[model samples]
Target: MARTLLIAGTASHVGKSTVAAGLCRHLADRGVAVAPFKAQNMSNNARAVPRATEPTEAGEIGVSQYVQARAARTEATTDMNPVLLKPRGDGESQLIIDGEAVENVGAGEYYEAGWERAREAARKAYSRLAAEYDVIIAEGAGSIAEINLADRDLANVETARFADADVFLLVDIERGGAFASLYGTLELMPEDLRDRVVGAAITKFRGDPSLLESGIVEIEERTGVPILGVLPYDDPGLPQEDSVSLPAAGETALYGDSSEVRIAVPRLSRISNFTDLEPLAREPGVGVAYGPPETVLEGADAVVLPGTKNTVDDLLELRTSGFGERLRTFSGPIVGLCGGYQMLGERITNAAVEGTGDEATVEGFGLLPVETHFSREKRVERVEREIRGVGPLAGALGRVTGYEIHMGETALTGPADRPFRDEGAATEQVFGTYLHGLFENRVAREAFLDRVFEYAGRMRPESHAEPSPYERAGALVADHLALDALGVSHENMSERV
Candidate 1:
């Protein structure tokens, strides 16, 4: 039986996911058999994990839980995230339970009829994981103090109650009003739930700790909960769980010289698998920025259209926002992944399957001579592809491994260049593929970036010397956390032996 600990937040994007991931890594390093859980996650950014019954069977879970499981040195399973809601357009979400998509439902309908089933799914998954791991670090969503939604908040209050988990309330100081927010959250929470909180940790603090000493003391004095360690604003550079964590618009990259190759990603309203850009952002002399929908594609060396939860709707949004118009005229190295790939085609058939109501066909960007048709069946699996083509990114000739999660099948109409030979098209500088984590493969990224820099008349910098993002996350957590207070004791391996 695993002992559970809850990481709850004062508000959304207050570092709950990062804290849980850090704790998972820290505990695993201590030889503790750890796992991560989130009863319900509302994010389009997801990762496919294996099923417990059939290891070969694949299913989707929140990306944060998947990464945390990796940090814990365990194979990711759907039990880690029992219920997932990928928001589609028109106030509806594709509800996934026990790692499979059941149906798409509106917000009101989901609460009225679907909440109980989701709850049961979480319970069963938690029970299975509890029996396996020695410790489970559960993550809570949004503000735990959302009074109106408390009864239906599956991730926070309900999880703590069912798991008998001790809570660590996290407040983001960089957002300002950390003390007030923490105090208000604690005050608003129900008494039974409030009693479960062990302490409050202030996150994203930029200044010295001593400056907050008096404030922390006052907060502790006002509330029964003590102040835990204050974590600095150092980003461990872990994969963010949601698009809400994106850097401010137009502030995506710190622009510098012509030597830097800037990649512009027009921010999609329903962007999914955003972590696909993380590897590119980490590349030496490369800057990845999220261009607003209306912004003109001017200075970027290359442009990437990212994956989306609702392909038709997001594509329509791009057109209405005028980005599609600018994109048609812009001549640059452009790449589209998954849903974005579908949008680059000439037309999309069976659009009603994606909740477009009666609309059967929608116009695409027409960059590639391809057509896509939506279907009830979804493709979600890990894949390794060989890059072959005579197009722009053909230099990226290697075995590229990634995953595909989409509801549409794109067929190239004319005899054109295929980047992955079978999966994607590469017409001149425009590339489209279904692979989500395409840049993670260094060989492919190197080949692709070499062409991009050559096209931009710039020199690609040498390989980055910084540690991998995951390594930095592990070190950051180990340094900032108070493990003793969290009931984790570092034990010598020899002693265990």
Candidate 2:
């Protein structure tokens, strides 16, 4: 059986995902066969991966696990994330077990009727992964000390028991209560699980590490736990795990200000797969901003309508807020992805399938000459499409790889240019596609940015190559973390063997 290390956080957004990912990369770089696991996750940001039981079929897993798999240098599989819960508002979430969609259930219903099944699925998945890998880095959700839900906390408490894992607690000093949070978390943790805590690490420190020397020593003496490391507050530009990372409504966040070109993204109430915009945001001169529907589209060189969990509801909200009209009048490059693509069409039929109302049909923004029809079946698959070089993607000719996870079908209602071989519709300045990671492709991204820069009458910034995020993360952990304390050798595994 593989050794398990549970990366549990003191609280939500305390850098658990990043710490897990960094450790995965660090171990993999030492030639250790490591795998990432998350028993359960609640996030709208999901990625399609191969199903464990049926390798030929596509299944969904949380984006953090998918990214961690990459960091570990292994193929992403549904076993990495056995159970996923995607929130859809109204105190309900769509439950997916073993990479397949089960149903939408409220919190009470899930705990009462679905919890056992989810736990069983997680157990089987973990067993499979343990049998294959030498080490499994498991990530916990939220706080490990949520005593109110301890019995049903699949990702943290239950994982600790079932996996017999050693826990590494992570505390975020940026939140301004590092010692108190760590002490409180250890105190509140179930006694059995608390004893499993091997060490604790404080993350997101801004200033000199020497300043925390006294506090770290005091905490260690009090809790009898070693302080593993104090990681600096540097982002390696990894994809965010959930909507909590997004800017709040009525707020605008701008990333990268060196360039005159700016692309505006309206923050959908239930935005999913917003990682598609990260690659563009990484560009030197280009700026990507997320704002509310009412004001985001104004004064932007280009616009990208991101994917949404509930398209019908978001479209209705946009129309009522007059965002649809603002979008129609703006004469810049406009692209919509997935649910956003559906919203760009003339109308959507069978809308009741994914909507809150009984309406059979709904009007789209009419940016594209296409119509969409909602269905019970959803498409979730990794795909590679040849760029047709139209609209925003003009002059970009090559294949781009991405995934599709949507609940509707779209067909053209009038003449329009095809953005991909036979998928998506486009005009001179408007484009729509079901492809989720479109901008990740260098050819496609450069092409789109070139168009946007031209429209804004600004020169495109020179591009520079950088290290891969996995490599950077590995270096970060290896340099700062005390691997010896965790029973991981600093020497390469291959060399030691």
Candidate 3:
């Protein structure tokens, strides 16, 4: 059996995912066989991993668990995150149980009838992971102290009970009221769950740690909890777990200003896997900005339509918002991914399958000579294919790996060049592909950047290698946190194993 450590947060977006990732890397560095688990996660950002029960089939898990698996130096599996709730607008969400899409249900229905099944699936998944790894670093969702939801909370309360895990509570000082939130959280948690907390750490502190000593000591005295450490504010540039990390719509967020070549990405209403643009943003001298459909193309050297949860709906919004008209007049390199690919086609049939409306067909932007048909069956699989090097990928020629998670089938309706064998359609300056994480490939990223810089008549800056995010995260945790107090040192290796 494996020992478990649950990383619980004070609230949503308080750096729980990052802290969990850091601990995963830190433990892996100490020769411990570790794995990441999130019993239930609600996020639109997801990645395809092999299903534990069906190894040959690809299944979906939240992106945070995927990143944590990488940080732990372990292969990602759907069992790492057994239940995922992808919100499809309104009050409903698509429930994924054991890496398969079960059904779409509203919050009330899920809690009333679906939660029991979800909990059972999560229990089995965690059991398998515990048997395989020496230590399981589990991440809690939202706040561990949601009193109203304590009984039904699978990610926090239920996990703490079933996994018999020690808890490390994380509070964000940047949000202000750090001590109050920490104290209140501990106070509100169920007695059994609260007793499981080994210690508390304040994260995202900007200034010196000494400034917080007096308050930390007082809080520890009042609550009978140890203040393990205060981590200085620093982002390791990991993939964001949800859209909460993204800038508000219509706001232009420029990553780097050194490069004159700007790649504009429209902030779709329900963007999914926007991590695809992170690679481009990481490139030197290149700038990737997310803005509204109307003005994102302004002064942009290239345009990228990102994947969305709802293709027909977002496409209709783009057209109504005048982005469709602006895109038609822009003479620059354009690329569409997944739902974005469907939007680039000539038409989409059976749109009712994925849309909220009753429409059976919807018109696409027609940038690519392709048509799409929606079906009840969604394609979710990891794929590797050769680049045909057409259109925006003119000079790129190599095998690239990515995953496809979508609800439609697309095919060419007219003569057009294929960008990735038969996977995507392309013209002279437009490209559309269902592949996610395309830019993660060096060849594809370089080729696309080269074309964008050329179109902007600017020099592409020399590339430089950066440190791995996992290594950075590990270093951050080791340098700041008191690993000894957490019983995560080399000396206790035998005991944990």
Top of the candidates by lDDT: 2
**Per-residue accuracy of model 1 over 1-497 as CA lDDT, tens digit each:** 67888999999998888888888887787788889999999999998778665678778898999889988889899999999999886798999998888999999999999999999989889999999988899999999999999899999988998898889899999888999999999999978889999888999888778999999899999997888688889887778788776655544543223357888888777889988988877777888878676763668878889999888888888888888788888777888889888888899999978846578899999899899999999988878888774455766666878788889788988876877656788788788999988888887777678878888888777774786555666776677766666565455322322
CA lDDT of 245 in candidate 2? 81
Tell me model 2's lDDT, rounded to 2 decimals.
Answer: 0.91
- In order of lDDT, best first, we have 2, 3, 1
Error of 1 at 23 (Å): 0.9
The digit string of per-residue lDDT tens for model 3 on 336-387 reads 9999888988999999999899998999988899999999998999999999
Clashing pairs in 3: 259-285
Could you arrange the candidates by TM-score from highest to lowest?
3, 2, 1
Clashes of each: 0, 0, 1
Local accuracy of candidate 2 as per-residue lDDT tens digits, 295-342: 997679999999999999999999999999999999999999999999
Instruction: Give candidate 2's error at residue 321 in angstroms.
Output: 0.9
Clashing pairs in 2: none
TM-score, cand. 3: 0.98
Error of 2 at 254 (Å): 1.1
After the best TM-score superposition of candidate 3, give how far the Cα of residue 286 lies from its true spot, in angstroms.
1.6
Off by over 4 Å in 2: 490-497
